[model samples]
Target: MSDRIVESCRMCESSDLESVLDLGSTPPSDNFLTLEQLNKSETYYPLRLVCCKSCGLSQLSYVVDRETLFNPDYPYESGTSKFFRDHFEEMAASVTGKLNLAADDLAIDVGSNVGILTAAFQRNGVRSLGVEPVGRLAEKANMAGAETVHAFFDPDIGQKVRDSHGAASVITATNVFAHIDDLNAFVETIKILLKPTGVFVSESPYLLDLVQNLEYDTIYHEHLSYYSVAPMRSFFDRHGMEIIDVHPVDMHGGSLRTYVAFKGAHEVSESVGRYLANEKEQRLQDPEALKKFGAKAAAHKAELFEFLYELKREGKRIVGIGAPAKGNTFLNYCNIGPEILECLTEKAEAKVGLFAPGTHIPVLGDDFLENEQPDFGLLLSWNLKNEIMNNLSAFSAAGGKFIIPIPNIEII
Candidate 1:
């Protein structure tokens, strides 16, 4: 890949962007390859991190276009994980009661994968609509009774939504705010699509948690920015919005449920100030923090590969569990592939027979694990450890050991 250079910050547009960490090159996560495509060529892009000196938003310097990165085959669905499904339902009730959304008013969800939250909103008597980029997921969401538009959200789409359904009373985006490249255009559209007194609620993986846990594998082409409360205050203020509330949610490692509204439309919560102060004390936005992250990542990579090598030397049969996107980053960055593990198993039928993009490791189904019963399992989706452990109790009963790759490599 040729060098795709970005001189300025994505959020603040300041030329004083500083390089912090680099994860080398990686293929688009979620780009699981078909059998025929595997024998063909695959592209990789630079995975790097840089910080905005002006606004403190950390982001990837080399950006892959949204259309190519979010290609039609993106296979994530919110309903896959029981945690997200239940969490969304709770969020729907909380926000509905907090904002007092009526049956006649609209709730608009952006990047609404499989419309899990949108459906939740509808179930609670609030009418809901979704804007999704992937066609297949959108189609499935519509089939499942969630009104969704198969297109990316932009200012033009916002206006069309307004013309068709009127301004939305509540705007929600979950896990998609960090993936947007053009921050300016997106917030402008949100401003246009929101009712004067409406609230915009969003959730994103917290930067402090990523650093604390050394969760560097979350860095990928799709995630353009890493956010903290310190930066968001200024970013929203510049776009004619105010940060009203910040609630730390423990899922996805750790994430922030941020509430925003037009400037002065809502009272600024004391929680926002507390988070800003906490970020400073924790050094969440400092350039030196990622240097520590880079060091921890390097150590983890070496330790994990050493463990795998020892297992291979002992002739232990190994396979992977849950073909999560984070697994691709860890596997590819550590140079582990088909030779290191026989195959990776996942529950998703769509990914079962396919292969991970860059590493080209085969993804298998439940029956494969039941029959093969490998000597060891690599818990790639370590974040889902508790639920996965319960699901794979049979493997453990059969004397199969599982290795969890995270803040530390551990065998259980």
Candidate 2:
């Protein structure tokens, strides 16, 4: 239950950090509570963002204990969403073809949750392994036929993995890259696990998109860094690695997929330069711009809360659509609870019977939408609104509307 305030930038170790956005304190986003645990006290940590003046990297101002944040019973399962499953499948196929990986070449997925990407790699005819920290998830991945090692990824684990299965041809850290607090150590681990010619690909929510789209809800304890091409290129270059390519992917609102290789191991793509130029054009690193973003987020929060209150006054019943971890941040920040959201519907069996971390909104199966027929559904997982809305078409057909509260407050 220990946490500490970060006084220096994680990427460049710069003490010249500027506070950008402060969302106050929040309980761990994934700490879904059991009925018995609801009555007990819950811990809350500071949820604030700061930008480094030296490297232009955006990161959290506080560091929550890794053990507390990612307990053995971590509830998120990447395979639970069909959208993510399909995305990972596409990622594996694309990386395999681009790298000309053969069946003999090994692919390792770092922080592979339930081995979704690892399984996708195996399906692509390459031998794949998953490195996951949570024992429960590792066991689940093994049961699903995706061999996984249950240990936190570091130089030691990387050496053992390389010794057992040979250096990896491709290593991926999709959405998990930003969760790392120690960027330097992580890169060292990547170097140890990868062959000289191997490529390390990381996909994370781009800081540019987060600021432009007012995606403040995505700021949580687990996501330490909000990566952009400029800072990422600088960081990799310092480690004697180069970003060979960069691509924007449509996942988790918006994400940047970066391909890294040992210096001169691969040809640099024009996309990297384009992304860097775009980031500069948008003033992604300007401290003033980030402060403005914080102001915009505060304004949006007010507007959304007012709108929801108005709807409630009109006697409309509202329930949350998807109980994603980011949704917990929004719920707690906006102070929306079971009073406003009757319940939250989720597809993950693990979360269905539990309650949201801070808001304590009951999580029920998606079937609850059809059975309860609430008047309006607050789309907590707004990134997957299309998929969820399409899946819950029956709810819409029954004259129910949806409220999308991110970027803007809209009823669709």
Candidate 3:
């Protein structure tokens, strides 16, 4: 009955924290279970956001433990989206060229899901290694011929990597940087692993973009910290590193691809200065902006539930589309259970055979939408609305409505 122990900000260890938003209590997104497991009492954990006054880092303080986040049979395959794979390839080429990497140089990827970008490095004859915490994903990366380490990346592991691979010429984390609970430890690891001339590159959904785009669904327990150029620069500077270059990539809605290097080893690019200026001008660090974002998200939840409830009252069959991780946050936040939606549809066979995390909504194959002919489909993965709608042209032709909730509420 007591409150769970709270985690301190990895950067500042400031207990001076306040909740920005509480998506109520919810189960971890990746804890999809068997039907028998479903019969047992389900457990829920708090999905709360907190802002650190000292460090200016927005984070979730509860640690759900890594086992819940990265299961052996984690169903999300990075290769499922060709669009993401292509982006990884292009990114590898661009960064390699920019860093002027030699054929013999080594590249290390932390949490390299399926080794997509690492494979790109291997193609150019650069020795590549991937460190993945999840057993299944690490196994997949190893099978793909990338030297895979089946463990989490931290200061110790970073040292081991440097000992073996002779200091990575380049280190990268794609959509994986935000999951670490220990920002100081993570940066220390990156510093120890990099060669004197090595660059640490990361791509993460920008906090600015998240607020501007109303991407409240991106708030999951796993993503403990959100990043922007401002906080990141300060975080790295403490460890004798410099933000050298930055490029905004269009993956995962909108993301910032950042490059950093050892202190005084590389020229701090003008882009870093420009980005900091922009952040100051826009007041991204202002606490009021974040407070406003929390309000906007609540309004979105209210609008979405009102519309869906009206549909249910009309005796219309409503089904959800794509059981994405973000969808779990939205569903739990809005209290949308099977009563509101019969079930959800997913393209992946693994997810289709399982149930949604918190709501326990039975996840069915895409055929469910095609055959059963739902009156309205709530596009849970609104980020991929264009792709899902295009693929479900048959449903649209059959007079089905698609409801997308985020940025703008629209029915197509």
Best by lDDT: 2
State the lDDT of candidate 2 residue by residue for 1-412, as single tens digits: 3677889988888899999999999999999999998999999999999999888999999999999988987899999878999999999999999999999999999999899999999999999999999999999999999999998888889899989999999999999999998788889999998999999999999898898899999999999999988888888999999999999899998998999999999899999889889888988988888999999998988888889888899999999999999999999998898889999999889998999998899999999989989999999999998898999999999999999888888888
Q: On a 0 to 100 scale, what is the lDDT of residue 162 in model 1?
A: 94
Clashes of each: 0, 0, 0
Please give the CA lDDT of all the candidate structures: 0.88, 0.92, 0.83
Model 3 residue 161 distance off true place after TM-score fit, in angstroms = 2.3
RMSD, one per candidate, in order? 1.6, 1.0, 2.2
In model 3, pairs of residues that clash are none
**Which residues of candidate 2, in runs, are more than 4 Å off?**
none
Give the TM-scores of the predictions, in the order they appear: 0.97, 0.99, 0.95
Instruction: Tell me how candidate 3 scores on lDDT.
Output: 0.83
By lDDT: ranked, best first: 2, 1, 3
State how far residue 30 of model 1 sits from its true place (Å): 1.1
